[model samples]
Target: MVFEYILKQNGIHPQNDLTIDQSIDFGSTAAAFAGGNGDFTVEFEPGATSLESEQKGYVVASLGKDSGYIPYTAFCAKKSYLKENTDLIQRFTSALQKGMDYVQTHSPKEIAEIIQPQFPENDLKTIQTIVTRYYEQGTWKADLIFEKESFELLQDILLDAGELEKRVPYEDLVTTTFAKKAVK
Candidate 1:
């Protein structure tokens, strides 16, 4: 929800004029293929006005009231490998930063063109909707200000999920050095 916080901090209301909703199904490969075509015969439609008793259609609904949140998994890197190949980590991070920059600067139509082919079933409109929402304000901000409120919210969610034993202090978990350099 870092995006939400950035917008809110700048007086952009995510909840007031606009509504927040997740995809019909969380990262469904099949649904992605059938996007907005009403072709799934099973997948829900985009912004569906009403539900039918028995018919192939889509459903527009709140992300909440869903069964469970997506789980967070950790991938550990071998300490020896990391220590010997620090450059690999740096390169990967740099590449990601460059990609985020490209996405931010490109027009939505341009971005849409690049993404459309991946999901042949999804009309350009559906892909556009997803891209606009995810990359809304632009740059993924690899070095953007590490807003404590955002992390705190994440920690709270994890705690509620019984994933965290005790909350860590902001200083222990995040650093602002990169963000400080970014604005300069």
Candidate 2:
């Protein structure tokens, strides 16, 4: 959807000029593009970075850097669950904020070494590359607040893609009350 949004911004409608071939996952998409299965495919890091490093695939654009602060990931829960587990949510957010802070202050190589246990299959160099790219791009946020402008950009993309019939107000969908409390 983001790639489609970017294409529209560049005045290239996927429906008219480009053939959109859907892939099951990012790695497969990168592999397909690298193998000449498609001219282009949208890939997220570390898959995108990995493809360029290992497969000689060229990156035409970076969605994160180019799109200007689109919030692609979020820690979400059901309304009922959230209502009941507010404290737990706050603790989780606080811990995440601390982790984000650590990443922001520390070197990407150090952060990668700390996280390498979770990704045993990937080598240190690949992990370092991915972490460095994300860190440099400001992909991770220390604050949990869902920025209204970023949310609106996501909504606009969805609306343009016909996934959303109407614009959903930010207040209705997101609450920063717990995040605010967590930050403090």
What are the Cα lDDT values of the candidates? 0.51, 0.82
Q: The CA-based lDDT of model 2 is what?
A: 0.82
Best by TM-score: 2
Per-residue CA lDDT of model 1 for 96-179, tens digit only, reads 456656776787777878979887877787767656644543324434455777567667656654678889997765654433
Candidate 1 residues lying further than 4 Å off, grouped into runs, are 1-81, 137-148, 169-184
- TM-score, one value per model: 0.49, 0.89
In model 2, the Cα lDDT at residue 127 comes to 91
- Model 1 pairs in collision: 44-58, 45-58
Model 1 vs. true fold: TM: 0.49
Off by over 4 Å in 2: 23-27
Give per-residue CA lDDT, model 2, range 18-84, as digits (tens): 7888745655877777777876668876677777888658667678777777876787788999999
Q: In order, what is each prediction's RMSD in angstroms?
A: 9.9, 1.9
